[model samples]
Target: MSESGGTFDLVILGAGSGGYAAAIRASELGKSVALIEKDKLGGTCLHYGCIPTKALLHAGEVADNARESETFGVQASLQGIDMQGVHKYKDKVVGGLHRGLTGLLKSHGITIVEGEGRLTGTDEVTVNGAVYKGANILLATGSKSRTLPGLELDGEKIISSYEALRLDRVPESVIVLGGGVIGVEFASVWRSFGAEVTIVEALPHLVPVEEESSSKLLERAFRKRGIKYELGTPYESVKTTDSGVSLTLKGGKTVEAELLLVAVGRGPVSEGLGFEEAGIRMERGFVQVDENLHTGVGNIYAVGDLIPTLQLAHVGFAEGIFVAEHIAGLNPVNIDYDGVPRVTYSEPEVASVGITSKIAAERGIETTEFVYNLGGNGKSQILQTQGAVKVIAAKDGPVLGVHMVGSRVGELITESQLIYNWEALPSEVAQLIHPHPTQSEALGEAHMALAGKPLHVHD
Candidate 1:
């Protein structure tokens, strides 16, 4: 490879959420950056992951509202969904965001390289036989959806989340393998789209990473939606029948569906990128990074899904900014991964920040919890949504966790994370008033109860 592309101040390996962010921010701080990517600029989150999945979820919401319009005093009939139109809308949204991102990178004066990148040296990356060197290198290679060892993704009967997004019509029935965030989100969409969805999880509950209370509420909601789920049962095998698919469980139980979606999770894309060959330390397929995102190789750093802190796009953005500032000698604060907000955008969305009750107990922190039912909130009754706000505080200390399960509760998690990260006591949070009749008031009410001044809460 010819070392022709001259040294830059910083070279970014992927233009996903983290890499693009670092490129733009480092450029703002007076560092010339080279942003290299194999596919689209916005990467999976914009093209296939967050943006598109959320659009499908929104389409599901629209369908649900139409089906249940009679309760709102509107006698409207729900017609069938046109998957073509849904895909059109999703693609349009993704394209607009991609264009905007491209424009931003151009305006920031960052060089965008279009090809596959590999680290040949500590401060160098080679793309299509062309070598680009930088005084410092940042790797943000991102991740890809993972599949089971024996399950082969044929992209038709057996599919990943990427293929599920491009289906032309809703399946009559779907067997979703995995009860985590990705599986549940797709299950919610398929159910709302009028499909008979069955979720299978090896875990004891759906969304098992969330608070136990939240998981129970979600299971109830899913049951009410007529979405069947088999928990604590491991998958045995799957075979494509003439029409759809036949999935077998450990107990010889069989499920027939038009499709099977594999949503186990995502794995870092670090295999063939030459990180190990270049002597960068890696653990369990993820690059090992310090608190400052350093890769322990000469001025090289890794961020985003490449480093296993959190696989969220927002987390990637924060890591990117942190790396950029740290490289620029600004010495930015390290991200507290525990305090990061997590949201599962399913029906009756689940959102939380900080440790759960289980985690707190595991850490030997005694806690006092208060649950505020949304049924008392005027807005919740008006919207006909059933859920609650839960505040988990220390026995006499600050709030450690805030977990919510309800419609639009994801929006309130920002405030919840703020309270957790700030180490605000229940009394401190109770001093402020949440607007009356709003869903957020449930949060305020929970805090009030935690502070020993219960309002609209039963003893």
Candidate 2:
């Protein structure tokens, strides 16, 4: 690590969600930032993960709507999915966003260094024998899709989400390993694209981190859509067949599919990046940081997937802003991780904010909950979606959590997050009138019931 150094107010490694965000904000506050990246500036979320996946999911929605148009009293038929066309659209969306992000960073007067950056010194990052110095260093290396032991990715038969995203066409059948957010979302897309999809989860339920009731509803919906899944089944092994791949479950049951997608989870990309070399403490490859995102080493901070917080990009954005303000000596408020919203964009999307009922009881907090079925919702019936809105509150206190499963319920979670973060009581939320015949009314009804008013909900 030779020093051909240039000093800056801040040095950020890995120009992903957190890194770019911090760079932009710090620059806005009159701080010179050196933002470095090995790959694209927008990183995995924009290039491979969120943006492209959502585009494919939207394509799936289009196919689904076309196929089921008869139910809407429309004569329409889904001829077939043109994956090339779909990919073109997805790439267009990604390209536009990437250009905007790149332009934004440049417009903010942030210096973007393109290379593989490693922390060679406590406040210095080395890329190609060139050292960049900073008053503070922020690590936002992000993450990569993880694979199981003995499961080598060939990028064809056995693949990670990265390779899966580049598939030219939907497989005739897919065995999705792990039923977390990534698993269910990809499965949802494949199923709607007319592919046979089966998900295998070692957990008791799909989307296991969500409320158990919400998981059950999604499972039921998937079943109705002919999306197969095996719950509480551990994966044993896999072998590639001439046709595709064979996945063996723990009980010796076997599943044959065109491909095996290892969507188990993402792991921090903190290894071999000189994190420990710079004396930055780490835990299981994740940079260890305090609530303020400080890494406990001189002028070092970490954010995004690299630090093991919520792996969502928005969380990364929030952490980036927090770190910038903290370094500016602004005494920024610490994030309430519990209040961060989570969503799984499946056919019946799942979204929640704050704590689940299971967590409430585990913490010895008394709670009362009310469920408003989407069956009674006018908008839901019109959309032909099945789900419910659940409101959980302290016995006589503020609304603590709002969980829902239905189409576009992710949008409603924003309001739920506001209610939870503001510590609004059920009565407080109930006082606000929700517009008539909308899916949001389901949330309103639940809050009303929880507030003891029971509007449109039976006692």
Candidate 3:
């Protein structure tokens, strides 16, 4: 192979968040890099995950708000949702991001190989049967949704997040399986579209990873939306017919719906990835790496969902930047997984970071919680959503976890993540005055009370 104009220093697979981030950083460091992507540039998050789902959720919120206008003393009318228009808007959103990525890659002068990449040997890779040699190789193949045994997604009745994102017609009724983040989110969307949704979760609570109190509030909020849930029960099986799907529960109870969404979870995509061929170490399905994000193989690295840390798109971006900087001879800050915030775009919008109150107590840590009622918040009252913020902290130390359930609570989690990760004490946070008559003040008040200096708490 001709060395062309220059010899590439790094070659990366999967032009998703991690891959493009690595390529851009590497280019900035004066490294000639080649990025290979089998599909569109932005990958899953832009195409099917974050961007599209949020758009749908926003539309769903609008639909619900329009229907509930009588409570606000104004009559708003909604004829029906145009599902085709939703798809158009979703596609338009995705296209804009994809175009931006293409422009950025071109400006950086990085070579774009449009094909599936596989490892042929150490420091060498093959894309579309053409060999490319680099000083180092990075594999960042992301994950896909794991299907349940008895409930496979067929894109019509049984569906996954992807199918949910591209739904052309809103179903009259839906039985959502696995009350995880995705499940509850779609349940919110389906319910807003006037579908009677029943969520079946094997866990004892909805959003099991969240604080128990937050989960309870979410349950209460969901019930008011006409969404039914069957928590702590396993779904026996799903039978699809011409009309729709029939879901059987553990107790012989059956739920018939025009659609069934299986939002169980996702698994890493490592099969046929050619990792073993390159002699890279991986466990089960995830790539194994060190603190520096380096695979055991010389100069080769792995990051993102493949690393088994937090399977979040933002986490992948951070890891990709970490890898590029480490290669450029710069020491980057290591991410603490505990401090990484997780959010579900449901009606109540679950978001949290650090330790839940339950986990802290189970570990024998002394903790106290402060709950701020959303009804006490002016902005929440304005939106007619009185969801509260719950903060857990050490008896007299830094904050442990912050959880919330109500309208528009996801935006407040950033403060929680920062405080927990920085070990910011309640006294320290309480000293800063937040703008009054705002929902964020709810956070400030919660901190003040937790610090034993009650501010807005009625005596």
Candidate 4:
């Protein structure tokens, strides 16, 4: 097809989680769809963010487990880490997902267009100077790693998470800035992979967005692993010399390392996309959309990090599917941002959905919280990690939140979010059994407490 392409029902920009899901849904609903991307078929999450990071974490876990195998009554030992082999494994995981996406698009009849997409007008998208008009447009270009001032990333000594994920050789020593989820997750992976890693976060605790107690557990766990850090105080600046990076801290403390990973955070990738000329409303850099995920332009919608909603890949997927259904006249159920689950997949993984205990207090919902210790869980003892599950509920109403920390607590977010978002009552959740002798029993106990009957704990 020429640059002057045929009309489509939907023209989606950036085929990552949101864009691809939207295209498939639109096509299944009998809409002619075109998806444009300048890079990989799957955006950062599939290529760099989620899939590859998890692969690295798995490898690191295996390495660490092998080293500590004696405690598990096994004599497992590791030969050295094969850095190239690590990369090979990560790439293989990403490749499988890439192929899966390709097949899904082909079967759904969504046309894939290769090139950068720009909204030249309200309903017009130009890819490689080819104009394609759509009845509607979706902008899901996603985001990029954001760096602090005076800390320019060269993808080397001063690197970004992008480089951290593709390291061919584990650095002998590394300094990480930003103790958020990304920073700590990489810290966990590298610590397990046998890197001398130190995390420097400006917050008083690691994973600042999580519950204070949860952050404390993660900090204690990392310390147990001997991962060092100068946290709570910001690093004033990073000076790179012939040898390595020298980070100057607030208290005039200085630390040096061969490499630095900046996981400060991510910013929306919306520049040069022509949103200004298209007349779509925007707040800050994110596109402004309504409850239906519709942009100000009648036939235009926005999702993913491009919109001012949550920047999570799952949120993007949900928003994409929601918009497609609204366009197809499905009138699907609206999502409560409060109900969406958020997880940090580090050791003693932090997960939560709905209002935090702190937020519940501020919002004044007359809230009460139930705490169930992972110390009592048989599975937690087996894994040698102890944490807690916190359930927040209205004094006389439904569940308001669920927060968890323990080995592999990320999986709990799914069930927690369901209870919180569905406005499920304590009685409702108490009715469900979470299986026997599993870590999930912690949640069942929390629900039981809120339901006026206690299980595994005396009230």
In order, the Cα lDDT scores of the candidates are 0.93, 0.92, 0.84, 0.86
Candidate 1 regions exceeding 4 Å error are 1-4
In candidate 2, position 407 carries an lDDT of 95
Per-residue lDDT of 60 in model 1: 97
TM-score, cand. 3: 0.95
TM-scores vs. true structure, each candidate: 0.98, 0.98, 0.95, 0.97
Sort all candidates by lDDT, best to worst.
1, 2, 4, 3
Model 1: lDDT equals: 0.93
lDDT of 2 at 214: 98
lDDT of 2 by residue, 42-62 (tens): 998999899999999999999
The TM-score, computed over Cα atoms with residue i paired to residue i, of candidate 4 is 0.97
lDDT of 2 at 426: 91
CA-RMSD of model 3:
2.1
Residues 89-140, model 1: lDDT tens digits = 9989999999999999999988999889999998899998888999999999
Which whole-number lDDT from 0 to 100 does residue 73 have in model 3? 92
User: CA shift at 116, candidate 4, in angstroms?
Assistant: 1.0
Query: In model 3, which runs have C-alpha deviations exceeding 4 angstroms?
Result: 1-7
Best by lDDT: 1
Better of 3 and 4 by TM-score: 4
- Regions of candidate 2 where Cα sits further than 4 Å from its true position: 1-5
lDDT score of model 3? Answer: 0.84
Lowest summed lDDT over 10 consecutive residues: which window, candidate 4? 1-10
Across 1-459, the per-residue lDDT of candidate 4 in tens digits comes to 235566899999889989988998888899999899999888999998988988988888889889999999998899889989999888998999899988888888878888888999888899888888899888899999999988899988999989888788878888989999889999988888888999999989998877787888788888888999777899898889787898999999988888989999888888878997778777778888888888868689989988877778899889889888888899999878888898888776888888887888888779878888888778888998878999889988899988888888888888887788778998889989888778888898889888878867854
Worst-scoring 10-residue span by lDDT in model 3: 1-10
Higher-ranked by lDDT: 2 or 3: 2
